[model samples]
Target: MNENFQAILLNVLPLLAIIVIAYFAMIRPQQKRNQKQNALINNLQKGDRVITVGGIHGTVKSTGAQTITLMVGRNQELTFDKLAIRDKRPS
Candidate 1:
């Protein structure tokens, strides 16, 4: 009985340690990045220049609850989902 219990504990301990290390190494950082992206999407404002994940570059013209309008070119306005924004650019 004692030997069986010790063997089980030894096997389980490494699995538990791997789970903890994986969480900190992969899961936690990904979650923080997602939160930061969500905050940026939610706080968008007009006149901000941004690039999309699709590589579109434009200046914000207006914002809606789920969508945003951008001025891409001369009289060229495009609409995209808020999540489409990848990063803001410095003017």
Candidate 2:
């Protein structure tokens, strides 16, 4: 009976270690990036240059609860979701 329990534990140990390693290597960094993105979206303001995930670049014209108005060109403005923004552009 004891030998059977030991065999089961031996089989489970490696699986548990793999799960832990996967969380640290993959899941944790993704979670951190999500948090940073959320913070950036929340802190968005007018006139901030930003790039979208689709590679569109624009200056922020206005901000709303879930959307942003971007001035993409002369006399051209477009609205996009806050989550669509990838990162701010360097000045």
Tell me the tens digit of each residue's lDDT in model 2 across 5-77: 9999999999999999999999999999999999999988889999999999999999998999999999999
Please, what are the lDDT tens digits per residue for candidate 1 over residues 1-91? Answer: 9999999999999999999999999999999999999998887889999999999999999999999999999999999999999998987
The number of the candidate with the highest lDDT is 2
lDDT of each: 0.95, 0.96
Best-fitting candidate, scored by TM-score:
1
* Model 2: colliding residue pairs: none
* Candidate 1 overall lDDT versus native: 0.95
TM-score of 1: 0.91
Residue pairs with backbone overlap in model 1: none
Model 2 alpha-carbon drift over 4 Å, by segment: none
What CA RMSD would candidate 1 show? 1.2
